[model samples]
Target: MRLVIARCSVDYAGRLSAHLPLATRLLMVKGDGSLLIHSDGGSYKPLNWMSPPCTLEVGVPDDDAREAGVDAVWTVTHKKTADRLTVSIHEVLHDSEHELGVDPGLQKDGVESHLQKLLAEQIERLGDGYRLVRREYMTAIGPVDILATDADGASVAVELKRRGDIDGVEQLTRYLELMNRDPLLAPVQGVFAAQEIKPQARTLAEDRGIRCVVLDYDDMRGVDSGVPTLF
Candidate 1:
């Protein structure tokens, strides 16, 4: 990974337009060919980012850019959407790269882990005619909680959360975006399943055309009734 702290301005041109005025910020260039721009605040979320399946080009500023005090330019273009994120560097405070190897990935807590297992065992909870493809379906970014097929045999990616929130929705969105780029799963659908879902997260998921499912843990576990089967 390459990390740079610099004074720069950013412009994004694609489905929408956005700009960040000149300021000192952190630029993260990950090994996966993704770029993320972060400010001093905003917690873990990047101020702006471009997902992978992209390219990055570094070039010296032209005459106009040089006269305006720009030192360098970094252009990141998305391969699929052709979205562009351009960063005009004014001054570099620090630059470094690290050799962080492959990650082990996040370990789900007990409840969440069990939820994934139960959901896989009872895949039809998603709806009738649903079939389980696999659990922990691997992707370039990370593992999706569950992968399945609906009645029409369309690919379905399920992200399981103990308490669904905006972050979980965003995670599922990224997974769907990556999966849809594959020819075998070009039209993958997404499901955000949790024991409880926040209204805001549900709104966001629906807005993105993702389905939201509320799971009943006790019922699935046979705690509410004598029968252990989902049916």
Candidate 2:
């Protein structure tokens, strides 16, 4: 079990790193509310917005509704200039044969990694806003995750985590403090990503202008399926 967990982490890290040629290192903030960013670099803008146009596509089984297989299919696609990222929510669907009956931690890991990839792609597409400045950055506090750049060279701090917990928020706050201290990161904003966010945390984040998002995972195959599908 331990080996499985380690392998999963390695695979996920490699996959994310490969997707970010322009980025140096990445971090993963766990559900405990602690952040896990890449040590290679820093963020591009102080306030990074994941605001890219997204399209959702649905799939239908057969003409006969009751006689088919999975009820629906969902595809989430994001576009930023020339770069595009697409994902099939159904791909993560766990069927009876491969029942991944596990805790939220294991399940959320896949979803969060997928989100991180798409986020990077979005940043890349919007090259005008920021560029992959370096792999690693040295801050007064410590080393940061991937760092990006705007035309003027300002930065935003992006922190990733599997779960959004108190620890995560506190860690993010620390990152924000470092950013605020740095003259280079003037006008920075913090971004927090995770599988799910508590309601209280949401309110706290709004109070701080920290963007807190619930990584909505799409389900199409089973009873727990998300977004309704269209045949």
The parts of candidate 1 lying over 4 Å away from their true place are 112-231
Instruction: Evaluate residue 195 in candidate 1 and report its C-alpha lDDT on the 0 to 100 scale.
Output: 93
Error of 2 at 86 (Å): 58
What local lDDT score does residue 105 receive in model 2, on the 0 to 100 scale? 62
lDDT per residue as tens, model 2, 151-179: 66667666556567766677667878877
Choose the strongest candidate by lDDT.
1
| Top-scoring candidate (TM-score) | 1
- For model 2, give the 10-residue run with minimal summed lDDT: 1-10
lDDT for residue 6 in candidate 1, whole number 0-100: 99
Instruction: Give RMSD to native, each candidate.
Output: 12.3, 24.8
Candidate 2 ranges with C-alpha deviation above 4 Å: 1-115, 124-154, 216-226
Q: Whole-model Cα lDDT per candidate?
A: 0.95, 0.46
Q: What is the lDDT of residue 38 in candidate 2?
A: 35
Residue 219 lDDT (model 2): 25
